[model samples]
Target: MSLRHAVLAALLSGEYSGYQLTKAFDVGVANFWYARPQQLYLELSKLESDGLISGREVVQQTRPNKRLFMVTDAGLAELARFAASVSKPSFIRDDLLVKVQAVDHVDVAPVIAQLDQRAAAAAAKVEILDKILRRFRGDLDEETYLRHGSPIGPYLTCLRGRLFEQEHHDWSVRAAALLRDRATRNGDPPPVSGQSR
Candidate 1:
């Protein structure tokens, strides 16, 4: 999906400054769509120019003035159109996966190290996403929240992100352990201490 649509969808909650939008994208939107801060700023300008969003300057007494933005009527229509369109299937294109694919033919030490790193990163993300999901649900239990929550889209997406990260962490740990076991059984020398490769 285009960053255009992502930005517009983000503004659906309410007005946000460029900085606020970037923060929102970093936390809430990063799961499904990844955009650099510069790219987000550029897309905001383009959307404003196209009349898909409107911006107003807000003055602060102790800080520089900032422009807050909200999606316009045209932006909603564009989002609706995008929602109605058929989505292309998603595919994985990971360098780590490529390395894993060739692990049997090459040195497995580096691949195992990378997998361990990935497992740690994914575990961290799972923890973060779990906290976010808790915040989204508030005092309501998961079952109750699914039946009665407002603004469920973001919560649903966050749930998907948590699940993906959890699975990734589990798989990475499993793959690393399996490789280590195989290396040991084959009498390959252990990876040197503090050696990532």
Candidate 2:
């Protein structure tokens, strides 16, 4: 999907400065869509030129002046159009996956470490997201919120992130166990006269 639609979707919540949008994208949208501050700013300008969004300069008391951005009708329309379109599924392109795919020819130490690191990062993100979700609960399950109130995109993506993170943790623990098992056996005698390969 285009960054144009992503920016519009972010603005759907409310007006946000480029900095705020960048952080939001990092924490909230990093799972499915990724964007940097420069990319968001460039897209903001492009959106403005394309009549999809509008920006206003906001003067701050003790901070640098920032441009606050909001979605225009055109932006909302574009997002709606995107919402109606069919989306193809995407899969992981992780370097750690590359190592796992070639495990027969590669040492497991570095890949194990990388998976461990990724699992830790995913856990940290889950904690952060849980906090955000708790703030939104208000006597309703997050699932109800997704079904009834507010835009479902963030909630759905957040669910995806939470599920994927859990999978990461589970996969990492399994992989680590296998690696540890191999490590433990590496220095042992050859399984009673090489019974099997």
Candidate 3:
């Protein structure tokens, strides 16, 4: 999805200044849709020009005036249309994945280091998502919140992110182990037809 849609969805929570929206993206939307603060600001300008969102200038005594943005009715309609439309299948285009695929022909040290780094990054994301989920749930218990709290879109997405990061971390660890083993056995005898490779 485009940054425009992401920005529109973010505005659904309420009005936010450019800086606040950037922080929102960093904390919440980073799990799924990644956008830099510059991209958000540029999209905000486009969204305003398209009449999908409106911006109001908020005067401040201590700082420069900031523009707070909110989604317009047109924006809501656009978002609804986007939701109804089928999305194209997403394909992985990760450099790490490419490296892993060609590990047999490359230095194992850097690949192993990348895997560890990725696992750590995934763990960090899991922590961030967990914190966001806790804040979203507030005083409500999990059962009560799931049954009768606010709409669970954000909660559900956060949960998905948490689980995905966990899987990524676990898988990375396993991949690193397998690669290490293969590296150690690089000159070992080839397996017989009936034996495991």
Winning model by lDDT: 1
Clashes (backbone N, CA, C under 3 Å), per candidate, total 0, 0, 0
Task: Give the number of the best model, judged by TM-score.
Answer: 1
TM-score per prediction, in order, is: 0.94, 0.87, 0.89
Task: Give the alpha-carbon lDDT of every model.
Answer: 0.90, 0.77, 0.84
| TM-score sort, best first | 1, 3, 2
Clash list (residue pairs), candidate 2: none
lDDT of 3 by residue, 141-188 (tens): 878888887768778777887888888888887887777677668864
1-197: candidate 2 lDDT, tens digit per residue: 88888888888889998889998898887767888789988998999999989999999999889999999888888988999999988766776877888876776666666666766776787788777666656677877887885666677777788788778777876776576567558863221111110
- How big is the positional error of residue 168 in model 1, measured in Å on the Cα after superposition? 0.8
Q: Score candidate 1 by TM-score against the native.
A: 0.94
Where model 1 places Cα greater than 4 Å from the true spot, the runs are 192-197
Residue 78 shift from truth in candidate 3, angstroms: 0.8
In terms of TM-score, which candidate is stronger, 1 or 3?
Answer: 1
* 2 against 3, candidate with superior TM-score: 3
Q: Which residue ranges in model 3 land beyond 4 Å of their true spot?
A: 185-197
